[model samples]
Target: MGDDQDIGYAVTAEFYDLLQAETDRRQARRRFAEPAARARQAILDVGAGTGIVTGILLTASAVPVHAVEPSAPMRAALLTRLAALGADQRARVTLHPEPIEETGLVRAVDLAIASNVVATLPPPVRRATWQAVARALTPGGVLLFDPPPETLPGGRETAARLGPVRVGPDLYSAELTLEPERGILRSVFTYRVERDGVLQREEREAFDLWPVEPALLRAELEAAGLHVVQAPHADLVAARRTAS
Candidate 1:
């Protein structure tokens, strides 16, 4: 979603983590940490939004990591998070302030993870990113990515509440809608802040979601010199680098 812009994690990073707090990332990192620990080289965290996954890898494994983040607001939040960690943890990470494709690394890592990002990008961007990520992995390196949803990007967000939180006397909330489409889905996010049940502020952000077919996606990754696997019950697309 970094087509010269942040992934519309709007309000300038104010309510990002709050709305995303529903997930227990600590528990979720188990599968990832296992593979990351066995990696023979550095790890890569593509679209390291706010460094959530990056932090998990740092604390769970001894391996060093390269974190590539392109959004200014998200990177600010990410740097803040990393700055508060121990010196050793900080030293183990190299920050790439650009998109993964533009990061200029070659077969540099043995494991990479792209979560909640790739499916939002259009075909061209996604293809370029896959090729670049494939080139950046060491032989047999594993790339674990989140596959797109059954619905188009913006189509899946419904009026259902995505996440809501209360801080002090203020409360923040957001909702999502998702549907299906062949072209890009323009999802709209509306946020409202309430102070003591009184409406304080309201804002809206637009995000573009792309559609990806599994067959085509698998072919693309295979053509890029990687063997692809989609877990039937999981929302994951795992690709391992193959022999040249």
Candidate 2:
């Protein structure tokens, strides 16, 4: 039942997929597809923004997918995407308009994924989410997620430009500021829409994220009854439920 007030995804939802097109494409191929294909039973897609990963999971396998998204706009986009899929794929998905901490999964899942979602949560919320995920997973079930790098600068500083990404007529520019003491990383994104080489509209959105160290995250997961394992990918962390 988490609201979108703090996350700011509602403001960015319209342009999110377009803004992160390249990164999403690469991750769909390199990260999501394989793990989804390996799922034998149910799979839970946490923070299923715009259904990018949810669509990938649907196409990769026939396993029932529970897609949890907290942002209303993002969930709307996800439902639209689901409607466009084949009937069989659509039938295999269940959309949950709630955060992972309140997943309300009917049954335990064999695999759960939360790409780029962990760092966005505050510390207490993050811990509660991990515990909830553990409870939703079957014993030995796998969980995969990517946390931000531990080296992220910690300090109050003016916004620093990250870079610009473009997809056709849409352009997105990113800037970041860090408040290390609070474990919050704030990112500001500016989206510009242009058609026929004329400026149309520009929008700005911001998000706050908390980055935890690998060791700290590992300890947290272990305390939640999960066995943490470093995945082959540097940014990815894979954990398995060790107890029922």
Number of the top-ranking candidate, with lDDT as the measure: 1
TM-score top scorer: 1
Compose the digit string of candidate 1's lDDT tens values, residues 1-244: 4644556564637777777733636533854777677777889999888888888888877888999888777888889989999999999999998888888999899998887777677888888888999989998888997777544443354755755588888898876555455567666677888998898998877666776777888888888888985442265779989978
**Candidate 1 structure, TM-score to reference:** 0.90
Tens-digit lDDT string for candidate 2 (120-206): 777788888888888888888988988755655755665555335556765555444455554467666666666656667767776
Residue clash pairs of candidate 2: none
> Deviation in angstroms for 63 in model 2?
0.8
lDDT against the true structure, each candidate: 0.78, 0.77
Candidate 2 error regions (>4 Å): 154-182, 195-199
Candidate 1 backbone clash number: 10
Cα shift from native, residue 67, model 1 (Å): 0.8
